[model samples]
Target: MKTALPKLEPGYHQRYIIPMMRIGKNGNKLKVFKIRTMYPFSEYLQEYVVGMNGYNTKGKPNNDFRLTPLGRFIRKYWIDELPQVYNLLRGELALVGVRPLSEARFKELPIDIRERRIHYKPGCIPPYVALLMPDSKGNIEAERIYLSEKEKYPHWTDIKYFFKAIFNVLSGKILSS
Candidate 1:
């Protein structure tokens, strides 16, 4: 992987890439920046990030032989997730908060969690990921673990997340590292 950041040329079609979700009851657009994971599905104008292993998801294998060589490299060190920091800089996301879901997945979300997940600006990274950093199972578990703490999460604020994020990073843990 290159040491340099690959900056998207200005006017990159973000809405086409990251996804803009509408909660339906109200008009809103929450920003997210993600690398192209799956080929775009015309029906949803989105792509899916295949989980590394079956663990706890329904997507086809991430290590499927079909992945382009670039895909494999991107997935290896999580370089694919780096673009989201731009989303953070733009204020569509916070440094810490629940991970954003795509409109397709968002629509499938139970109303309450969807409502809560969208309440705070979604984040470039989330907290419970500390313990959940192994693989998709850990990602799933992190979210489950977070569900109990979700309500208080908002009041928990940015500063708290920053410290915890530091702890997790220093310890070399991540929900999907």
Candidate 2:
């Protein structure tokens, strides 16, 4: 689905919304829509940024200079992720499950986790939110736990995690990163 995008202010000259290639179910790649939250051409510098600063506890590259000031604000509140609803509607994503990892990040996962991950659709709310573990290590552990439980009780697991994540976000116990 394509829509007309308004021109953003001077520093934010990229299109308002952008398509990101994310790993999806069955190890396929899909275009995920998200509001643009970085300066133009930021995608080209991802490797350099990650190499120099490394990933933060939240698994995002540290000292990312590409984020526009408005981008930072929108990301802080997850407004930048709103356009992902289109993906959800298209059945490429779930309301509650793991966040789709970028190609580089997906490659960093353990072999078993990577195998397990491709079996399910990526979600809007990740397991880390429900588990209250926001660090990189905790994030992986949370996903592992979630995937294990999901294997036994797919629907129930998503239902439980969804509510828990909602509660955590609502109560301010877990802030979006």
Candidate 3:
């Protein structure tokens, strides 16, 4: 993402710490890195994602406008996440699993739902049916449908897409986002 986002938005530039990270698989705070999508030292960093301040705090969509020409592109196609390959190389994530969420969101999750993710590692994509959330109308409902079939999450529902998505990434089939 650091190498690419600039081509999309010229003025955008930023760095990030993604603070108060949650622990790792071995029970230590995890802090993987990625390229920035906001302006340099953005003021928004001080602002939380969902404002719960306890769990899931890391998932905030701050509505920042610091995107550079390239930054926009990276985010559009989620290319900014490429650097996480280093994390995977180091075993910070799995090829397929539940998406890591803000601490606030994680803490806020219902016990059953939260525990559902405990069996797997965080990863590049979520097991979610993202298409439903595209219109911004069905995140909860989609989650409900997914929850009813909890045994099929990130594994059954996600593995196929994960492979397909990886292939698309390798093949350059989905870009310019």
Candidate 4:
């Protein structure tokens, strides 16, 4: 939590932490805190980036120039996501479940998935990590699979997926983006 952030221009003061809206439990929107990994005001350029490079396999805008060099490193290591521990503590997230998605990304999901997702808390460790398929389509399918199992056995499903995700990460089968 004490890691140093890169400096912006001399006169520009950067806010190292940012809160982004994500779909939360029961389809409510909530602010989830994250360590900043982009230049200031970069959120305003979402459409521009998408227009230029479009979403990648992971459904993120490709060649997103809004990212700072340090930001890229932070994202790669998931340092930017560390602050979500606060969200977890606040009961907005679970240890294992589908990932919380931004409005744009959430809309891209199929209607059924979208409907089911909101019924459960988003998770820190999503199914993609355990499945080792870190792309948009894979993520949705993995979530569908997970959700199905969760419906049958909620607590047991979480326990199973948690260990799988942990093992995959520790074994270098998956890396955060």
Candidate 5:
């Protein structure tokens, strides 16, 4: 048996400052910072891959080949997301809420859900951490529940979900996908 080599050279530095964007509150478009975790040009293939592979409940595609080995580890521990702290500092994101979606993903959602999601800023810790859903549909449902509760409880809803998401991360009950 022969082992395969990586298609591209290892890119530790390239991973540090990749620029991406996400849908923000009121449908504002925001540039989000992240460590690059996928193969070069992976973003261009997102739709094709998602169509074929389908997203897990967490909204990650199953058996994604775009991820490099280091990327996988980075994603598992969410090291890839560290740069998004800048987005938080910029007030484009909350400590707890739904994960931000790309324009393509956002457009794929139902109109009503899209309207509801855009009502609040996206979050660093998503509702999925609290609900632990089994599929993308379940993740959507979790977000719906969080959004509804947020409408009723506002600060308390975020505070409660924030703590729950933290506990889940610390205990390794949920991980970035």
Candidate 6:
């Protein structure tokens, strides 16, 4: 007998919605909101896809077939991330903090980094937005700097980073990937 595929909810294919849950501070699980940028079931293929396609400078799978043409446009202009404002309002995210990771991705991080990340809420704008890292290591380092500075100056650090990220985005120095 053939197994039946699960039915996607009405408007799921047409509307913006996060494909999966993300790991949040204190080990909480939350649904991160994003415009659906990939083909159906792409979430299940993340590791395989990345391994096959290799990572881009921004650390995303390069030349990924999963992305639709519209998705690419949305990502280029950072429109795909607009739904994350809902996550922010819901208290699952902040205006500035480390980007939330998927469970699989979070587990791949070093123990110390994971520990540091779990200490604060995830953010809509990642630290790399301000620094424009060229690789995953640079991304990690940027997050490390942000998290460390946050510990020393919680409010001021976020405020500073928030403005910097806005500046970078507006200047076209950073685009969501």
lDDT at 152, model 5: 98
lDDT of every model, 2 decimals: 0.53, 0.88, 0.51, 0.84, 0.83, 0.84
Candidate 1 vs candidate 5, TM-score winner: 5
Name every residue pair that clashes in candidate 2: none
Q: Please give the RMSD of candidate 2 to the true structure.
A: 5.9
Candidates' TM-scores? 0.58, 0.90, 0.56, 0.87, 0.88, 0.89
* Cα lDDT of model 2 by residue, 79-116, tens digit: 98899999999999999887798888788889999999
**Candidate 1 clashing pairs?**
133-174, 133-175
> Candidate 1: what lDDT?
0.53
lDDT string for model 6 (124-158, tens) is 88898877874777778888999899999999999
Worst 10 residues of 6 by lDDT: 11-20
Off by over 4 Å in 2: 1-13
Model 4: weakest 10-residue lDDT segment is: 4-13
Q: Is candidate 5 or 6 superior in lDDT?
A: 6
Cα deviation of 64, candidate 1, in Å: 5.4
| Alpha-carbon runs more than 4 Å astray in model 5 | 1-15
TM match of model 5 to true structure: 0.88
Candidate 1 local lDDT, residue 48: 38
Writing each residue's lDDT as its tens digit, candidate 1 over 1-177 gives: 645534545655434345434332122566455565444332232233333333233122444544446655675566677877777777667676666665655665456666556556666666555444445444445655555565665455555656777776667664232
RMSD vs true structure, all candidates: 8.6, 5.9, 9.3, 6.8, 6.5, 2.8
Comparison by TM-score, 2 against 4, better one: 2
lDDT of 4 by residue, 1-177 (tens): 574544445544266877777889998998888888888877666767878887777656888889889988998887988998999998888989899888877888899999998999999888888887787678889999999999999999999999999999888888877
Candidate 6 residue pairs in clash (backbone atoms < 3 Å): none
Ranking 2 against 4 by lDDT, winner: 2
What TM-score number comes out for model 6?
Answer: 0.89
lDDT of each residue in 30-136, candidate 3, tens digit only: 65556665567443343343242322211334344445677777777776777767777888877655555545446665666566555556665543433223222
Winner on lDDT (3 vs 5): 5
Summed over model 3, clashes come to 23
